[model samples]
Target chain A: MAATTEFELVSPGRLLLSEPVEMVVVPGTDGDFGALPQHAPMLSTVRPGVINIYKGGRVARRLFVAGGFAEVTQERCTVLADEAIDLAEITPAEVQQRLQAADDQVKEARNPEEKAAADRARGLAQALAEAASAAAHAHA
Target chain B: MASLKDLRARISSVKSTRKITSAMKMVAASRLRRAQEAAEAARPYAQRMERMLSNLAASVAGQAGAPPLLAGTGADKVHLLVVMTANRGLCGGFNSSIVRAARHRVLELRAQGKTVKLLCVGRKGRDVLKREFADDIIGTFEEQGSKGITYTEADRVAQDILRRFEAGEFDTCTLVYNRFRSAISQIVTLQQVVPFLPSPAGNDNQGAHGGHEAEAHALYEYEPSEEAILADLLPKCVGIQVYRGLLENYASEQGARMTAMDNATRNAGEMIKKLTLTYNRTRQAQITKELIEIISGAEAL
Candidate 1:
């Protein structure tokens, strides 16, 4: 078996990444899962969390994806995210600001559906902010 | 014949008209560049969605418990026509061609003893369709003030369609729009949006993987049931399709306008040339007539 699997990340507007990697950790809706070379074909809906790509037995890149889907074949893993951003690009201040906005949205929501959506937004923002904080602490 | 002053005034008017058309052509050309980029950018997402759906659909085809969006409602007595055209006119035949195609579809449905509902997406389309199918016109949308088409707009339209479908308003839905080919050509297209008609063969990924249908069918396994995944993806697919159509329509409108304005500018230039010739000839005639009379007077004296 090849030591690497073809991994691709696609958003609505553009294709962000397509390459071969040693391992990829996807934030599946059920839970996080790792895919390596020659994995079984499976499809899972993604959640809003960080995806870690490994190469040479170390973490090479990290990306945060807003909910989408992932399709895995034995040789390929394709992630179709609604939105994606490099973890290095987001600042803690921006994450805090987004979390505050999501909180405001939840409070101002008038209907149950609106409130649910705002709550989901808040949860995602909170998770993202926590991830950022954890990464910052690890560096510090 | 008209007076010299009138000829000169007509020439000036034609010259101004030519200027306006030339300016419009430039504007459309610039807008077409942006619209074309937007259309091209949207294609990858739409195509990928189609691939994902095809993968899911290939498994569910001929199954008894398929989603309504794929398996259809099992009836085609009522049809909804979502006609898309530019809100503004002056683009030679862009709007007319779409409306004409829509009208033909409506006529055919009527002939087949089917009920047809018209959901017009732009003012020009509504204006043309309501003249004949006022009662059949169900909804109308105008995007005049919006700077550009957005995914949110497409989602809203798709949501409305889904609501109507759930209400049992229509059994099938089709979209009519002019597919932008180039600045000089657009082809009117009629596509089935609701209860998607899938062409299993000739997909990009299938070719890329070099796998036949049977092998693809055997390879993949769904995490949640295929029905659950399809239920989520189908609405999203509808939104993607609508978004693509709007983008294509925007590009087509700009292309048509550019071509139309180019033709108008040229025609206006020709008219100005003809008018200038008449103006010059009339002025020469008046001068010669006056000179002849003066000469005759001197001769008589």
Candidate 2:
């Protein structure tokens, strides 16, 4: 529909994805929101969660994005994410490993600051793991 | 008088120095490319931030409910000057130029009877400011192995400044740096961090291919009220600003260093050429003198 509204997603080190996906979902800090062609201009913080993009008529091109920002202008929705991963490339095992490591970090934290940081890592890792699994199940 | 051998040695030394300077110039040039790319990459973020900030500023000023970052501390008694310079020397006047600008501002502010505290980011800037305002500098921030200046680094610095601001250490803040214009030119810049006021005429100076009304009075909706959002945004804004400054400084440093080294290499080459000519002349004169002396002695005998 409407040639899959053109949108560009960029991250540091390199330009990750640039395609006219049908609908791109963003995990804003407030909540997860999806955008199509001709969306309203909005700026919001992004939470650490899965950014499920529906390329090819709302049924393809899924991705998992870490926390950062999602700014939507007239025709372009830019995701300034800290980290983004193509669900196709993200193995569930990797997330589980990170989750385990984060769990250990939180458990062994000696100070309040370290504990808080580790807690954040743990929360982020758990969310990532869940998102990755969900993507795998939905695709299967 | 120096002998021909000494001239030859001096020529060789100058030639070696030229090689070193030329190598340094190439290194600086390559580094400059990456630094400039980073600076370019950071521009969009800076623009968006400034846009959001200006919009928020308007909202804050209108309701008299703006955060401390936008509304300011309502006091102009104390000032903080955060000066950023390069770490190493041989960058020509890049470091000195920024220090000079900061010194001028410090003098002007001091004359107005304002209490000021200085914060130096780079080693060169710190060394220069410490000479006069040694006791005033509360912090010197330049760690080599920190994996470049990150958002966290900026946050920490901002936290220190804000902590001091809250504690009444300083009521005002200013940052001095060099803005990279081109490979050969960098303009010394001074920006006010606190009492954030977006230039009213900023839109008037926009590029020919842009909008005005949208830019002049754009509005921002707060998911959790303006104040709360501002509370979170202020510190992040500080971090972003510092990060931008660091990036800009990185590019400017490499640019200045490259130009400086290029000039040095050229000067060294000139000196070597003159030395070599003098060495050849001295050797030729020595040979002629020996030949004439031998002829005279033979004639006398």
Candidate 3:
């Protein structure tokens, strides 16, 4: 039997998932990182990407977070996401619409701060679109 | 002293009132669960925000010329009170308690020769505060009988307050709202929001109330400049705190309504029982009088 690590995912709306998993991959602001049992304590700001939970060396669940903060301890990894959703529920059409809207926002921005925010939004939307397409490819 | 018809009418009225109160109690009880869940679900985010702020605040605590929102204007002459209460009135003393606390704070500030400005979130508080502090009220926000509270509302309120604060309208800001303790109890809490104070001990909220010792000791390296992060996080912090307040107030309102309606139902039942007894006694007396009248008429014949 493989050692398991406790993983907890929380959004502002609710605690989405909490369970013991074989491993978890986090999309940190710096880069992607993997956590398993007895991982060192660390804290990182999460970027907008998909968080994969693994069991028996296979992916068990995939959740997309807009952005948030992640805290990893020796025994547990907790992610506090701004907004979260199941990858299975994301439709390609919705992602495309979000990407278009974000791109429009970028063009409409008048100030540097506004442009920065809009750019971040556009980047996330693109990432989401890519993730959706990748999932479709896997299904096909 | 009332007539038989009146007694009978009173009994029926009391019975109907009991039914209504019981129905309200059931509704409140069901609503309380969702409200409580919303509040609890918000706890992790709120606590995380608080912890992150505390970390940043500790770093910038004594730095000269800190952000106005954090260090304040260093003037205590003007105070703004963000008073929150429920829109509806049947929730026992929930609204009254919040108003009373705000009233007390306003009076205290006045005693100290300070100017107090009121920003009421719900109609109940505005209604009560307007009586004595009509000129002090700066703005009012009402829920419009919404079935559920939302983060969008809180964000709108936060933006308004931020604009006001940036305009230098007030030197300090305090949030007054009911903290839901349980289905039967709510504690009216006065928390200083605008010169952000990290609550020294215990979770300011119930769901994520404490055990943050690890984060407190761990030093963090900021990816971006601390100032940039604070500038972005501070405004959002205000919104998060306000959202938390709204959730707490909603839960408290439902909890209070449930308890109040339960009591009202019980009282109505008691009144119905008393009215029914009087009604029965009156009917028996009227029957006895008729019997006596019949016996007397027979004797006379």
Best by TM-score: 1
> Candidate 2 — what's its lDDT?
0.75
Candidate 1's residue-wise lDDT over B212-291, tens digit each? 24435655666665666788788888887887788889899999999999999999888888888888888899999999
| Ranking of predictions according to lDDT | 3, 1, 2
On lDDT, who's better, 1 or 3? 3
The collision pairs in model 3 are: none
Candidate 2 lDDT by residue in tens digits, A1-140:
45465565654323467667778878776667887776765666777877766765556776676676565655556675656777788787888889999999999999998899899889888888888888889888
RMSD after CA superposition, every candidate: 2.7, 3.4, 4.1
TM-score-superior candidate, 2 or 3: 2
- Where does model 3 exceed 4 Å of error? A1-8, A18-47, A52-61, A70-78, A89-127, A138-140, B200-215
Task: Give me the candidate number with maximum lDDT.
Answer: 3
Q: Per-prediction DockQ, in order?
A: 0.55, 0.28, 0.35
Which whole-number lDDT from 0 to 100 does residue A111 have in model 1? 98
Best by DockQ: 1
Task: Estimate, for each residue in B256-279, the C-alpha lDDT of model 3 and write its tens digit.
Answer: 999999999999988888888888
Flag the better candidate by lDDT, 2 or 3.
Answer: 3
Over A1-140, each residue of candidate 1 has an lDDT whose tens digit, in order, gives: 33999998987667789899999999987789899988888777887888999998987888888878888878778888877878878998899899999999999999997899899899989888877877677567
Q: Give me the displacement of residue B36 in model 1, in angstroms.
A: 1.5
Q: Report how far residue B80 has shifted in candidate 3, in Å.
A: 1.6
